[model samples]
Target: MAWKVELTETARKQLTRLDKTQAQRITKYLRRVMMLEDPRDAGKALTGNLRTYWRYRVGDYRVICEIRDAELVIVAVEIGHRSEVYG
Candidate 1:
């Protein structure tokens, strides 16, 4: 029962803006997310819309990701900075 995490295109571009250390940090966070049995267990909040956000803190940066059910799987829609995430 492992959670599946998928990165959106925007998130992929955002990675280029991060420093080497931060990039590695994001990779580590992905590993943790992969180990999750339930995506919601690691989810911090849900606005009751079509979105749920799972947060992972890496130093000063926050990795904000979205989860949605795809058949029997949970899909990670996007990942980005906290500053521009909620807005």
Candidate 2:
């Protein structure tokens, strides 16, 4: 099965603020997620929230998103440095 990826406004803003390395990291992580890797196999989210789940070590950044629509899509709401990813 295949799914569609959507970038939220927060994520779009975060992308512009990242350095080259950070951007690359985010891209790589997004690819893995696009391919639909099992969440359990992924690393910790650093800070676990009610609506957001984290997929850590997305290259060098953290991917903070929510699983919705029966897990057929991802709302990549935020991407940022590990320290800034949560909270």
Angstrom error of the Cα, residue 83, model 1: value is 3.1
Best by lDDT: 2
Clashing pairs in 2: none
lDDT of each: 0.63, 0.67
Which 10 consecutive residues of model 1 have the lowest summed lDDT?
Answer: 71-80
The residue-by-residue lDDT of candidate 1 on 25-87, one tens digit each, is: 877777777777665565566555634565666666666666655532444444556676556
lDDT of 1: 0.63
Q: Mind sharing the TM-score for model 1?
A: 0.68
- Can you give the lDDT of residue 51 in candidate 2? 34
The superposed Cα distance between candidate 2 and the true structure at residue 37, in angstroms, equals: 5.9
Query: In model 2, which regions exceed 4 Å deviation?
Result: 37-40, 43-52, 69-71
Each model's TM-score, in the order given? Answer: 0.68, 0.72
**Residue 39 of model 2: what lDDT?**
45
**Residue-wise lDDT of candidate 2 within 1-87, one digit each (tens)?**
555567799898888788987787777766676676554355454342443464546655776766664867766777887777666
